[model samples]
Target: MCGIVGAIAQRNIVPVLVEGLKRLEYRGYDSAGIAVLDTEIKRVRRVGRVAEMEAAANEINLTGRLGIGHTRWATHGGVTEPNAHPHVSGDLIAVVHNGIIENHDEKRQALQAKGYQFESQTDTEVIAHLIHSYYVQDRNLFSAVQKAVTELVGAYAIAVIAKDQPDVLACARMGCPLLIGLGDGEHFVASDVSAILSATRRVIFLEEGDVAELRRDQILILDKDRQKAERKIHVSDVSLASLELGPYSHFMQKEIHEQPKALSDTIEPLLEAGFVPELFGANAKELLSKVDGVLILACGTSYYAGSVARYWLESIASVPCQVEIASEYRYRDAVANPNWLVVTLSQSGETLDTMEALKYAKSLGHDKTLSICNVRESAIPRSSEMVFYTRAGAEIGVASTKAFTTQLLALFALTATLAKIKGRLSDTQEQSYLDALRHLPGSVQHALNLEPQIKIWADRFAPKEHALFLGRGVHYPIALEGALKLKEISYIHAEAYPAGELKHGPLALVDDNMPVVVIAPNDVLLEKVKSNMQEVRARGGELFVFADLDSHFSESEGVHVIRTPRHAGVLSPVVHAVPVQILAYHAALQRGTDVDKPRNLAKSVTVE
Candidate 1:
């Protein structure tokens, strides 16, 4: 996803815009730029990180009372200087936009026919030209932006400033997350709350199709119907520490170690107060009673989390569960059950594909929706019928660490709650599950202790180009998550297969050069998975097994085993996820790649 930050203030706002982009660097960007309204439109665009943009801004003494900045994750064009954001239209309007304009080509064609030329191959540039066309007619930037957005078709959050209007900033949102940050003698707009967290604690979350007019001291919002609207300004509780590295070399490393506290924060209240239907929402009890099955729609790491939950939901809750990739699910038709609860999982809660899929599900009459997300008040959760927040704090890493584990814990809670609600779980089972959850923080801490050993294992993994992850039963998804982590941050080609499937086709690729990693928790299928390990070993493939304490696997010449902190039984998937995260972190560190902001990936998928 791209990051957009803008300000209308009494003083020079370049510093604020630059700082906001720095805060958003973790979201992953290939190019950064800023445009300020000074005597004329002063612009500095760079095809690199935010620091480069900041350096260029400082070197040129770029300053203005109103400005917009952006870090682009290239949607319509390549990562080049001309493709960077803060795209301008003949020095009249500067626009920074996030999201793909679905009809950008048609709009560009229509504009070209009107004798307007284009500079860069970006959908964002068309937005500036379109706004300029409207501003030329009325000389009103606010009204011009509103009129331009009405003509565009796609999901977008955009901030625009006109050369004629130096005191106002106009922004709008549709099917994407955007909000206004309230400040003294200054007002701001950003795609993510984290971008402006340092500038203002108070914010107004704009609804879909809402347009905002920001002045130095006031923020006027217009609702979807073009009527003046008043949105609530809540004081954000996210700490500035979420953006800090704090004792760690990288945000990914910091987030990897933060899992223990994140797990504790996610499960403590529910475990201490007891699992009631009201934990989800006021109508959650009734919703749970009428629910027939679960259909989980997610992407990336969250999709793997949902896959892991499918096993628990079937075994513990006795509910049929299905996991689908949100990107694909949105385009395909399937049997929709009105009583089947549709659950969406995300860390940012603003993932565009998942959000759109949620809408598509509702279009088919599946309104019983639930969100398991980390963000407090994000788009998906706000749109869902019920929400269970995963308090993993702010996950800045492109490769997820604390958020994935926290989602697993939240899914585990949902599984237990549904089990108890349907009488599938007994009183003794609830207490036992609660006790294990209470001790989970300590188990996670012990898993963190494996970092030293994982670093050593990463040394071995660094020189390898291919890896195969193997698992069975409930641990299969854990293997998939591990392989995803390995490839995402480490850049190694990796794939996962169910251990039983090795003989079917995957064995043909096994060799001495290929590293085979197995998730062998001491569960019912431990022996079965071990037998699969032998098949890899017979093919002279080096094996890396993530085993539990009592699993009795040893470190031999070809067989390397890293034991987790005992095992959490049904919660073992949550525990096994930690070592993989640490392994991926250390592996990326050894390979000298960007761990927090992986190449070709952004922290949030805000566009499709």
Candidate 2:
């Protein structure tokens, strides 16, 4: 996933573009670059963070009222200066793109035949040449971008500027996200709202095949057919303060401590006395009552949240549920039931694999599509029939913390709503669940208080090369997420298994050097997982466990126990997630790795 920010204003926009790209740094990028429409097309690029590009840009002193910037996460090219974005064509046209061009090879060959020289190995370079080819013919920047997008075969969110039209900028998007920010005598476009939030909160979300022309005085929007179109302007509620780290060392650590507030924000609406299923949508109750089962599709941390939801749906709602990784969902010929309620979970809502999977699932005749998304105006939410927006605010950390917990809360609420609609839950039972939801914020905060003890485990785990995480039942998914968080930032090889499955294979991997983490909540599975922990201890493996106070587990020769807060029946997964996140955060901090931007990973996977 790459970041793109463009602005057309009456004053010099170089500072605006750079600042915007800085805000988008959390999206994950390998290189940074910018292009300004001065007397000539001035460009600066570097194979590092936005700060490097900013320093390099200041030296050039490029001045212009219209400009575009990009933070590239390399797709088809290596990390080098030549592969950085803000790619130029001829002498005037400059383009910055996000997402992949599936037919770049074919298009590149066609351009080569026309004597067009390529600069980099990136698929985005083909777009600069393609747009320039169209611009030379019509000499109209808007028409050039519109025609060039029609020739493409894959996802792209692009911004283009020409030296000839210094006052004009054009942008278009399909399959990836792009939006416009309305300002006084100015306009801005970016792949995400966080990039331009400081300048304007009034945003116009672009659809799958929308193109926008941004001029200093007027802005024009067009659809795929080139017809004039209109999109609603939304005033975002995310405050600028939410994007900053006031007292934390890194954003990951800040977000780890923000979980309690984030959980409260997410569950506040559903905790009301008379809350109903219509909170999701008017037809939510009717459709959920008729559905025979649930099918959940997601990727990465969101998939783990869905995994937890599978247990909740079957146990609490008494509905059959299945969870599939979005990337492999379409490749397999899985059975799609028309009566199954399809739920798609995503934080950015622009995950390309998840979006394509949602489309493919729809084509197979399933109409009951619902999206649990963070951004309400994002592509996946727009395509779905109904939506549940997660109020986690802006999560800037590449290693997700608050977003994951909020997703679990949202899915849990969905389970309670479905259970009430299906007559499995009485009014009193539902109220009891709501009461737990209301108290979950404090429970999360109580878990957060264990950070000092969790950090001690991280200190010991930082030097280990291998680890094993164990959980069972609903907590199995939480264990998986714990393993993912550790490996994502700390780079330690880790794996997770259901405690029962230890004897099947993972037991042999246990040794003196391996750190085995146990998520031993005070549920029925506690005794079973205790047995699994004994297998590890019997083999000389070190045990670091987060257990409930009443579980009666104590520290021993090889076992290090960190007693967690009170047991939270079904909602224990959300509460238990805190220590896992804290462990990963401090471990990565101990290892001196880039905790916020891990190696070879992007925060949002906008491309398959």
Candidate 3:
């Protein structure tokens, strides 16, 4: 996923573009560039962060009334200055793109046959040439862009600026995210809302195959059929300053500590009023009542949240549940039940694989689609029959922290509602769950209080090359999430097992050199997991256990124990996720790795 920001305003827009890119840097950071249209197309690009691009633009004193910028994550080519965005054609047209063009090679060959030379090895550069080829025939930037886009065959959110049309910007979106920000005597376009949050809160979310013409005073949109269309502008409730790392060392740590507030916001509506199915949508109760089974499609951390929900849905709601990795879900010839509720979980709501999976499910006669996402007006939410929004705000860190817990909160609420609807839970049971929801924010805060001691454990883990995370019952997904965080940020090789499976084959890898972390909450399976820990200790494996307050585990020669807060039954997974996040953050900090922008990872997976 890359970030794109464009502006058409009365004054010089170089500073505005750079500031927007800075706010949207979490989307990508491999390289950044900007192209401004004044007397001619002036451009500067760097094979580094946006800060480097800003410095280069300053050194050259680049200025213009309208401009477009991009921060790239490198899709088709390597991260080099020439491969950066703001690619130009014959010094007149400049283009910035965010997605892959599958037919770029074929288009490039056609352009080359016309005696057009290519300067960089990128799919984006072909777009500039293709637009230029169209502009030569019509001399109209908007018409040229629309004609050129009709020939392309993949996902893209692109912005093009012409030297002749200095006051105009043309942009389009197909299978990727692009939107317009409404302003007074100025207009903006960006891949994300956070980039333009400082300038304006009012925005128009462009639909698929929509083209926009942005000028200083007005924005005109055209539908896929080349006809004028109207779109509603919605105001965002998110504040601009929340995007900043206020008083925190890194975004990861800030997000980890923000879990309490995130949880509070997510569960506040559910706790305030009694369980109402309309919280999801108008006819949510009717749709949920007709459902007999649940199918979850998600990727990465969101999949782990679904895994935990699988346990709750099956046990508490008496509903059969299945979880599938979104990337692999659409490729298989799996059977789809029409009565099944297909639920997709994503933080950005624009994850390509998950979106594709949702489409596939709907094609197979599963029209009852629901989305659990943090964003309100994203692709998945717009395509769903109902949506449950997680109020986690912006999670800038590539590795998810607060978003995961908030997803769990929403899923837990869904589970309780389903249980009550099915008469599987009594009023007393519902009240108990509600009381636990009221106490969850404080429970997460208590978990954060353990960070000082987790730092000591992280100190020991920083030098280790590999780690094993073990859990049993519903906590197995927690172990998986923990291993993923460790590997994602710390760059440490890690794996997770069900603890009972350790002796199956993983026991051979555990020894004095490898550290084994156990999720030993005081539940029914605690004794079974303890036996598994004994098996590890017998093989000379060092152990770190996160036990509940009442668990009878003490520190020994090689076993380190950190007592967690009291358990909250079905909500234990949410509480357990905090220590895992803190451990990963502190471990990466001690290891001197980039915590916010990990190598070869982007915050959102918008492309395949």
Candidate 4:
């Protein structure tokens, strides 16, 4: 998951490219680089944050009408200046890539035999060499790029600039995302709309195997065979204010605190739209009404949200639901039934595995494909038969906070809709669930109030290298989400165990050095989770808990409890998730890690 931005302006565009790179910095930050073609050669590449790269580029001459910039999340190479993107060939063909070449080894071997020496240990270098090789034979940049891409396998969204064709930039996408922005006397291309949001609202989302030849005043779309193709231009609705952290310390913390608004945004639209029939349209409602089961595919935090939703779907809707990790779902020999509804969850909406899984399910004739996503007009939503959008705004943190909660909110709303559609819940029950859904915004606000206390608690546990998260029943998935977030951003060795499963194997890891975080929300399993906490305490493991308000636990004991408001069985997962997010945020802060741009993590996993 890397961010790529390119611009061909009527005037010097280095500042615009740098600004756009900064906006897209949340996607990746291991290294940043820019290549601009002007009267002479100007290139700046560095192995650090965007700010570092910008500082280095400031001292150089950045005058250019066309440029491309990249913030890399390393794949197939180490994080170094030589490996950073905007790789150039000997003839000054600069390129920025966002995906891995699966057949790079074969391509590199052939190129090496032809006396093409590689400088970097990246699959992306193959693209530069291949393009250079084709240009040497064809002498046409666009035709050379098309020919080179025909030989490549795996996902890629690549933008290339040649010194001979400084007025033009050619871009192509396979499995990865690439967008072309239509601006006044200029053109822009980026991996996502966030990079070009400030410069242009009109964007042309390139489909797989589509290439665009962008110039300062025009853009042309072409197919794999270089045939002309029509393109649709979509106007983005993103606001500049959504990218700011506002009053929060980091994007992660700001997103954590924004859960209340995010939930409200997701719920209000559905409530105002009535029920399932109105939200999913006639086709989706007809299909969902006869669905026998649901299979959800997602990755990381979104997968954890699906785990929690599985319980809700089974319990409230009386539908058998299975949650599968998208990265592994396609590789397995799983059965797909005609009555099965395959749902995919994604925050950026461009997650590669989730998109591939959706396509695979559709290929199996499971037409009832639904997507739960936050970003509108994303790849997943475009490919699904129906889509439920979560209005979580812009979640810039590499470790997701708001996106997870909003996904849960959307899934819970869908569960309620499905329950009503199936006639499983009575009027009073539906009313009760609806009322609870309305009250969630306030409950999330109450959870946000615990941030200061969590920060204080974080100071005590941040020094520890290992931790454990435990929960029972529905809270078990919440514990898993918590542990995933902690491990993702803080680089902590954390594990999540169902409280009941601790005795099986995880209990052996408990010691005084291990800080165990227990999700003990008051429910039927509260006592069970408490007993598990006591077992950890007996083994000399320090405890941090998000307990129910009415749970009977001594406050002055060794246990650290962050009390959550008492809620119904299904609602506790949404409430209990907030504190764990806060814990991860504060812990990362205390450890002095880059909370927003964590190491080895990207906001969107665009490449499989």
Best by lDDT: 3
Q: Write the per-residue lDDT of candidate 3 for residues 1-608, one digit (tens) a residue.
A: 99999999988889889999998888899999999987889999999899998999999899988999999998988989999999999887899998889999999999999988998999999999999998988678998999999999989999999989987899999888999999999999999999888889999999889999998888889999978999988998878768889999999999999999999998889988756787788879999988899999999999999999999999999999999999999999989899999999999999989998999999999988899999989999999999999999989999999999999988888888888888888989889998998899998899999999999999999999999999998999999999999999999999999999999999999889999999999899999998999999999999999998878999998899998888777799999999999999999999999999998999989998
Q: Which is better, 2 or 3, measured by lDDT?
A: 3
Runs of candidate 3 exceeding 4 Å displacement: none
lDDT of 2 by residue, 42-73 (tens): 89999889999999888877778889999988
Full-model lDDT, candidate 3: 0.93
Tell me model 1's lDDT, rounded to 2 decimals.
0.91
Q: Which stretches of candidate 4 lie over 4 Å from their true place?
A: 224-226
- The CA root-mean-square deviation of candidate 3, after full C-alpha superposition on the true structure, stands at 0.9
Candidate 1 lDDT over 175-273, as tens digits, reads 888989999899999988888887899999999999989999777899988999999888999999878999999988899889889998998778866
User: For candidate 4, lDDT tens digit of each residue in 1-608?
Assistant: 89999999888888888998898888888899999988544789999889899888888756689999999988888999999989988856889999889999999999999999999999999999999998878567787888889999999999999888877899999989899999998999999898988889999899889988898888888976678988787898888898887897898888888889888988897667655655654577787887888899999999999999999999999999999999998888778887988999999889999999888888878898889998888889989888888899988888888898889988887788888888998889877778888888898888888778888888887898999999887889999998998887787889999999998999999998999999887778877887888888889888988887777766656688877777545788988889888888888888989888887788889877
Model 1, position 352: C-alpha lDDT score: 93
Instruction: Output the lDDT of residue 17, model 3.
Output: 97
Task: Tell me each candidate's TM-score.
Answer: 0.99, 0.99, 0.99, 0.97
Backbone clashes in candidate 3 total: 0
lDDT (C-alpha) at residue 111 in model 4: 96
Total backbone clashes of candidate 1, pairs 3 or more residues apart or in separate chains: 0
Between candidates 1 and 4, name the one with more favorable lDDT. Answer: 1
